[model samples]
Target: MKKLLTYIIIGSACFSACKKTEEQLYTAQDNIYFDLNFKDLSGNNRRMDSVMYSFALFPEKSVDTVWLPVRIAGMRRSEARSFRIAVDEKATTAEAGKHYKSLEKEYIIPADSGVAKVPIILFAADPALTSKSVRLKLRLVPTEDFTVTNPEYDSAKVIFSNRLEKPAWWATWQGELGNYSRVKHELFIRAAGVNELPVAFDAQVLPKVLFAIRRFKNFLASPISWVADNPQEGYTLEPAGAGKYNFFSITNPGKKYLLELNPADNRYYFTDETGARIV
Candidate 1:
């Protein structure tokens, strides 16, 4: 009878040990991993894999606040989660409450959702904005619900500049501006020593405009403009309506510069006034 009792007790202890181990394993498998979504800026849904995740804020416009998104990469849990955020002063140049406002409190990622936002309000009218851009560097800290898997993506920066700087695409064109077109606005960027070509003020203008501009700057411009050798014949930057623009060459006033999306060669050529490609 003692042997029988001893066996019963040993079996119960083993069962308890197995149950605890199973619980521990389940907890480990349910660990959450989170990362900043850099594609929020690029629209690619993939991390940019760069040193700094930078976002541009145009405070001159009515957009006073921008939301930076953080995402959890693992399985979504039924319970809601709150993540911690801290300003990395070493990475930030903007002052709290002056250039930008701090987030009021912790933000909760909703249950079964992978995304959360940290809203940063930019003071576009701040006097400091006139001189240069103020940078806000934010970092995601680990919380009970999740761990930041990639430190590089866990940090992001917001650069707020009221000044209109000449885009990098301007280096390619030797174009001159005439009277402002009804469709576009012309202003000289203060520090860039070049005119601002805001062709329709949309996001996709950078790469397309750069492809044509550099070609004009490198190959064309015969003491006149980016499009032609003669003053009256060369090309100029002009705005077309509805967030579109083209290289306007006087020789063919009706011909519009067309930017092809994702061509195999990836080189944009300015077409002639006859609607034929100049190349």
Candidate 2:
């Protein structure tokens, strides 16, 4: 069977800013790691299986649902299985009663198939659980004439922090690079506690800048030559200074370009006129 992979940006905000409270800024350097192991009914290895795991953060001390995916390979036919995840002794005092019982599920790994994976998302259901660290254990039971070769397991943790002031416009593009290249780029700005402020730029400036680079694509090898050839037409290029202007531009040889005055890194991103990601 063919495998599928997908990525979804759950929540994102581009032009909006977050508000900070009067509470002292909280800084945390806590890091936690998890170790996972899997075994079958006969106490043997299950090397032919893989696992996917993830976790989310909840405020006000609450336990949330976690999703885990299990993949099996090197199987002859379909199979039935049951699995459960446990917390460490230090994590919780809940007994091994109905709450800790494993959920029953069945899976089929096709004959001569490359690999098969299953998702097991369950609720931890801890209402007053706000600890920064948690441990999980996996148990599996298989039905059929097969052996558990290699048990596969992995773990992840989430970090929490307090929100800070809104970022400034100049905080977006701050970095150092020797040459130009193509890649995905991002821009971030700090608000400096001032709300409803907009970055000033002429409406016609970007298109004209792009047109100049398109006309002089060959001379973009050298940053000096590229800037000299492709000067800003309608707007004045801000010189390197403290607060007046901190912007720069670059032009590549007919490639994509980006000229970010306020890059996401809190520095500046030098780009050509074509709006491609370039350093």
Candidate 3:
């Protein structure tokens, strides 16, 4: 009888452990939040009312085991509609650890909802990137049941910029302005001068440029002008030798700007009377 009791106790413990594991697997994930607002060409704020939207993972980060959330607001419980999310082919892979593919999934927001949140799980070829930060291109569309009046009512490209390392820029600035996006708004001096030596400058100036670019991107407009507000600013643009110099290119339509000094292999170059490379 003692041996039988021991077996029962061991079996009970194993069952409890399995139950705990299952519970962890099915736990609710944290809510992904995005504050939405509308902006015009001038970068002014325009309020939107009861907007309905959904988001999906980018093809590069979509894994079979990965689950993403699609939230709906101002949706009624009795209103059911279908929506689609898009994934990029270039960003997708098929390898085990490194390969990721975009999964095309359709969802129907149930009408029985009162402020409902939906978690859409993506089944991709790889499982490792399930938790890694990746950008997903998502499109929300109305199903046959609903009609969208706006022709632009296709999908919204949502960017997930959470990662360990932020984007970097390498270029030179001339008279007016320069712009680049960093992981943190807090700018750090990686190097200074042609020798790429350590240096310091007015931290306040960096924020002005960074904030301006962000405002441009957010407002989908350019900064009206660049400012060199700090009189005590230490950094200076060292003159490059005689060559054709190219100013910054406005990749996006906005007041924010970026400048490139002597871009190699391209026709654009900055030079003096005698043709030579500038610093």
Candidate 4:
């Protein structure tokens, strides 16, 4: 009998506390924070004021959605509540409905939920991404239902681009591919459908990569026309063995250069009078 009385007293106190909290929730102010994180293709973990996105990494994707995580500081009510967010036009470089989709009329924190996401949609179709990057800056707007909270997480910026960079592992292809160039890297991505080669290197893509290499070689060797046009002044290249060649000077045949792929190691150099390597 005593234990039953104690249970009833504890249950009554819990009910009173919940009722009090329910009453205070309507009077208290709710706040929303623009919490964001950066998860780029670099595979590094970091906390940043801005998020970095690249369309180059996802060549096939025409559009990408970046979620702006928002946190509610106040109580979670039973009824769905709407909040507002605004983009700072002065600080933003990306245009609405062009570079990125416009924000919705309002964002909502569903009933009994303390978190929500505001999406910033980016379009890779913009030619600007190919030459330069664009930035979308957003901040929480205080409305009747919710107020902006936390200075650190009050604003979020997303920097997106389609610019290309040389892969760190490009040195591995020197012996086979000869040298690195911007045009070559661009061709490599189109052939491999990837920004960087995989560590294991899938054998299936070898033929496509070889095809791309052949195209690169054709581009570099296109001066066959110029040489033919100016045969008197243009030096003629004589093929040696094993993809190696001798560039004999047209005016001074005594001077020759070994046109060779040194695998990025200093092995190719000017030849002596006897066509022997100077080094």
Go through the candidates in order and give the C-alpha RMSD of each one to the true structure.
14.3, 26.1, 19.8, 13.7
- For model 2, the superposed segments whose C-alpha errors exceed 4 Å read 1-67, 75-101, 110-116, 151-279
Model 1, runs deviating above 4 Å: 1-25, 29-46, 49-63, 169-279
For candidate 1, write residues 91-158 as lDDT tens digits: 78888877777776577889988887667777654544544777787777777777776666677777
Clashing pairs in model 1? 227-235, 228-234
TM-score for candidate 4, residues paired by index: 0.56
Per-residue lDDT of model 4, residues 1-279, tens digit only: 999999999999999999999888778798888656556789775557898887666544667898888888888889989988889899999988888988998989899999888788888777667778889888888888888757777888998986666666677556556556543454344333345653445689767666655644443444234345546544576778875776544543433345564556634443333444322
TM-score of each: 0.48, 0.26, 0.26, 0.56
**Model 2 TM-score?**
0.26
Tens digit of per-residue lDDT, candidate 3, span 103-138: 446655566643223343433333233235443444
lDDT of 2: 0.31
Predicted model with the maximum lDDT: 4
lDDT of 2 by residue, 1-279 (tens): 122222222122221222122122222111111222358899985542223221211111112233444444333333343323233345333333312334345444444542334333333333222223223344433444233443333322222211112324222212212222212211111101121122343456545433433333333233344345446521123454542232222221112123344534554444532555343
Off by over 4 Å in 4: 1-26, 37-46, 169-178, 197-279
